[model samples]
Target chain A: MNPTAIRLSPLDNVAVCCRPIEAGERILVEERELVIDVAVPIGHKVAFVDLKKGDKVRKYGMPIGSVTVDAPAGSWVHLHNMKSDYLPAHMRDAAGDQA
Target chain B: MMSGWLRSDGRKGIRNAIVVVYLVECAHHVARRIVDAAADPRVQLIGFPGCYPNDYALGMMKALTTHPNVGGVVLLSLGCESFNREALAANAQQNDRPVETVVIQEAGGTRKAIEAGIAAVARVRNLVDEQAVRVPLNISELVIGTICGGSDGTSGITGNPAVGRAFDTLIDAGAICIFEETGEMIGCEGHMAERAATPQIAEALVASVHKAERYYRAMGYGSFSPGNAEGGLTSQEEKSAGAYAKSGSRPIDGVILPAERAPGPGLYLLDVVPPGDPKFGFPNIVDNAEIGELIACGAHINLFVTGRGSVVGSAISPVVKICANPETFRRMEGDMDIDAGRILEGRATLDEVGKEIVALIEAVAQGQATRSEELGHQEFVLTYKSSAPSGPSCMPNAA
Candidate 1:
């Protein structure tokens, strides 16, 4: 069977879950097999190596953002622990304009 | 090759629809009612909602009215709006596109204006129909644009790459291909610059992305969204990288502003982000506005990639929706023309899907209605934005 997670590039620190991965499920990353410690939903990111706070998170071979807290290998990397490192993201205001 | 309608300027059109444009917000209802009353698929509705005049809006309206797909035009004005209705009608007439104007205030009221509009549409439609001439059109004469909406993690991996492959094929066939949303491409400027055809174009590409970065930053925003993160995209640059894949691997031929036509035929990048600061609120308030800009630049059709599925079609041009998520395709099969998400399931390869899309484009151009077109999704929108004319460096090989 193909791996449940897909790694986009050799430089990427995280892999995208092609299918929902359960806690303790085994997956392969660059010929190295690792066990997940958390349930990573489909299309979410799973860190392949432990990363500290403010470390750049690489995906598709480039830095997508930075983590806000120290995250261990096999853990979920998402909005809860990472944020955009470029310009501040524009959220919908009370008027609900995309601006 | 397909038989098509030949326009006065030696350009071939895939469709011969009559466009009805409302010059201002006040006249929108009357124009829409007129289109509804005509009940003809050859008639479409498009308009601008501003009461104030903007050069970009005026130029875009002119470009759309005379687009190869349009056989004629019917302009609706509210009588006191700042938009110059007479100039628009004159331009359409100058291009030999039969045009008629109806002013609501001058025509008495809304009811009377609608009555006049319906009658005028019938006359215009008959004129264009009588003028139609069947001519042979090849893929080289086609200008195709692409945009990704409701993007998710699956979009970059499946839909975008499939589109990239299609773009490469189309470019090899000598067709003009364009991809926009510079704001979404902020983080990938360095990567895109290397693929530019000329050193000047490479500089322009980098500068344009930097301009977008500055503009979005001033608005205290990046183009990233909560849904994007939910769908496995973590940062603005990540989404940019995914969006950048639609350009394929071809060297970018030129950089054109929103309303400017392509300089000859090759792959081009459209700078949709307005120059200067965030004066017009957002660069593109939504995806449809970007589609509007694409149509203005003379695209006969648009290939829209959506993981979350957008059901929008343009007023003057048809939109072919490609679904990126396999599960989403299963749920919304009726809305999409191509199911690119199958690549993820091992059901198809990327090249297979790319060929399917190219064949579908020829079929669609030869009068096969897209699912969105059949569903009557004529969503048209244009807002205020500023732009300086493209420099000589932006367009290579000028007279």
Candidate 2:
């Protein structure tokens, strides 16, 4: 992650990828270096730490959504593993297509 | 500083526009013909198609008719619509803007009404051109609004923040700025409330987002669209993170419902969703409805940020399109005013693009046509929605 991923706020546990990150790329978060487990496109979020099911995903230091399944650090965090706590995000309907 | 046309209400406008409104869908063709036949760039068309009277639509039409930018308004009625055309015409007249109405049934037929409307438009155009005072305009007099349509992930990173930067600059210099779409700003209410200038305003801001959330939830859908996901947005909250960037880092001044003018200068948030139960089908059916609300709130010019790209301009005010995606901007060269995608490519920095946008606004205020305007993209739409009238607390300064 060196600086390719934008850390919006220090309190956030996730960072938005400023540039696309390939699988196995190194990502730096909170002084810890982690390898991205999968390719994440620009603007998509990447986990800064190991996320448990029901953990709140933070970006810009605010809770964007909640994780639905446990995910390791640096994994692409999107519709597959996360769901909005406010309303059902439309991407859930076409989850299979996202892959 | 640029010159603006002075209105009777002491507010100056960047353009002296003559708006032609059709009371119902039946008179749409005649209204369009009148505007087209006038063959003048200053004459623009806007209307409500639903014959069933909606208080929201009437208020919006009244606001537009007397909007600072509008020099006059022509109401095209088909004689048998539920719309109250008299109230709109009276509002225009009360505001001292030339007002006229042509009822198709009363004018004998479509052809005669068109002739009457054309004549009316010409008379108003001449009267406005002759009477409008050219006054020195400064940044303080500006009321700028920003909105995003066809947003992708890149929008939050590029165009949105660029507009944010520009909004910050304008607010720093004492100009009024507004950002809207509460439905899109969900999940950030806590953070946004922190920026409110007053504690009461902060509470109001949070309530507004909650209102949008409740309304959309009842509709069985979030504001997230299929196009949004296709363009790299995964969820409503994710899109909101980007959409909220357009507000920059200014203190929230106050809130205003649709068709209510901003009380004074500084940064204001427009709550587009209705207050009570979801009476209206949707808050806003499309982007243009939101734009219409912005215009009704007296925005002199709108900065429309688009990642997927939208080619739309308002009737009363010029819309400056800022393209967020460099790839999309490349594909549609002439439709956008600012290429914010340059931020992504590193060809331009955020500050550079922001300054460019501010400069373009000044240039446009001095009477330069935006790309959408030059290309004839006058897309206007007004849908039904109701909100309780704003209280004195909503406009802190005016109160």
Candidate 3:
């Protein structure tokens, strides 16, 4: 089977999509079957385990940010659910709106 | 064996370039006109736009004018700006480089200054041709720098790690490898500290990253940008982990600030963020600004890894572009030097690409032009900033 995603570390709670993953597609991660709930673009992250708000989102064996909202396994994890612990991520529209 | 121009300071350079430098923004047009009129690919334009005198800018100018790659310099001044042209010219002359100065006020006007600058460039070029001595260069004598820009998720797994492997190969060959942008290294401090060769250097490494965090906080922005977010990086630390992979697995020899050369041949971290309170607006406005700092530190060539595909190249030193995303590589193949994305596509391994990068570096060192140079990309930028001198503990291995 072709690899669909890459998990950087064994301790990571999320895996990076190697190619665009379609919604409602069933994929096996570490032999566990997961039904992706939403389309995740390539390079985006997908939760490997269920997460609660305030939980640390782990990647590369470290906490990248805190989950802002509860997300289930196989769900897309991004700015909407996770935010940086250091500084807020800026988007092009948000920057232009401030300007 | 590769041959290079040997400078009086016992440094070897792969390229013998004559630079036209404008001391202030007012003299920029005339300096650019001079370079354009000369029509020589070896002649390039660089300048400081600040009308106010800045110690950092002055020191960078002095370092760049006497850099190993530079054989001659032409200083352009507007006569009213605060930049000290005389001191810069004297520094270049002291290094045995052909130097000339043209003050716009003294030379009458813009047209006249351009005329004088063109003639000065010609004279400097002639002097450089006569003075430059060809000498055999060894791979161990080279200084290489690495930086990541326009990064995304694929960078860490592909191009960044490949560059890291290449850095390891270069360091083993006794070449000096420098990795920079402490602001982008936020989440990897612990890993870096553990890799430090000395206890003092470990402390210095952690301190530099913390300083960059505080500096970015005060400026209301981390190095994290809109493009980074759009490219699928959710946070600064996430991006940093990918950026950190470019340093390879070597024990870090030291930590040095911008314009400070590494004391010996090993991996060194460059702290691009200035010290003290956030007086300057940003640590680095663009990728080119960081490239300037690397050049000032005597980097002969820089490896630039990009997942979102940045095409920028520096003025003084050559930038080897590494594309991390296979899709991006297919789109912008002409601008990239290596397709590290093949690792992700299962067409090649990281070790294979790493060896390819090392081979490319050897070819470039032997006087081959990079894609950027062939396309006439000589982008340069410098801005105001302040930094106190580093302590001896920063380089414990240095005598």
Of the candidates shown, which would achieve the greatest lDDT relative to the real structure? 3
Under CAPRI classification, how is model 3 graded?
Answer: medium
Per-candidate Cα RMSD to the true structure, in Å, reads 1.9, 3.0, 1.3
Worst 10 residues of 2 chain B by lDDT: B390-399
Q: In terms of DockQ, which candidate is strongest?
A: 3
In model 3, what is chain B's TM-score? Answer: 0.99
lDDT (Cα, 0-100) at A70 in candidate 1: 88
How does model 2 fare in lDDT? 0.87
* Candidate 3: C-alpha lDDT: 0.91
Tens digits of per-residue lDDT, candidate 2, B1-399, equal 699988888989998889999999999999999999988888898988898989889999988888888999899999999999998899899999988899999999999999999999989888887887999999889999999998987898899999999999999988989999999989889888899888888888998899899999998777887667767676789889889999999899999988888777889999999878889788999888999999899899999999888888878889999999877899997999999987776688899999999999999999999999899888899977876888666666543
Off by over 4 Å in 3: none
The Cα RMSD in angstroms, rounded to one decimal, for candidate 2 relative to the true structure is 3.0
Candidate 2 chain A has its poorest 10 consecutive residues by lDDT at A90-99
* Candidate 2 segments exceeding 4 Å error: A1-4, A19-40, A91-99, B397-399
- How many backbone overlaps does candidate 1 show? 0
DockQ of 3: 0.73
lDDT of 1 by residue, A15-98 (tens): 887777899988887776878878877667888889889999998898888999888888888877787877654333612674
lDDT ranking from best candidate downward: 3, 1, 2
Worst ten in a row by lDDT for model 3 chain B: B390-399
Full-model lDDT, candidate 1: 0.88
What lDDT tens digits, residue by residue, belong to model 3 across residues B368-399?
99888888899999999886888888996644
Ranking by DockQ: 3, 1, 2
lDDT of 1 by residue, B1-399 (tens): 687789988888899989999999999999999999989877999999999899999999999999999999999999999999889998999899999999999999999999999999999999998999989999999999999998888888889999999999999999999999999898899988999898888888999999999988887667776567667777788789889999999999888888789978899999988887788888888889999899889899999999877788888788999998887898999999999988877688899999999999999999999999899988988999987888787876642
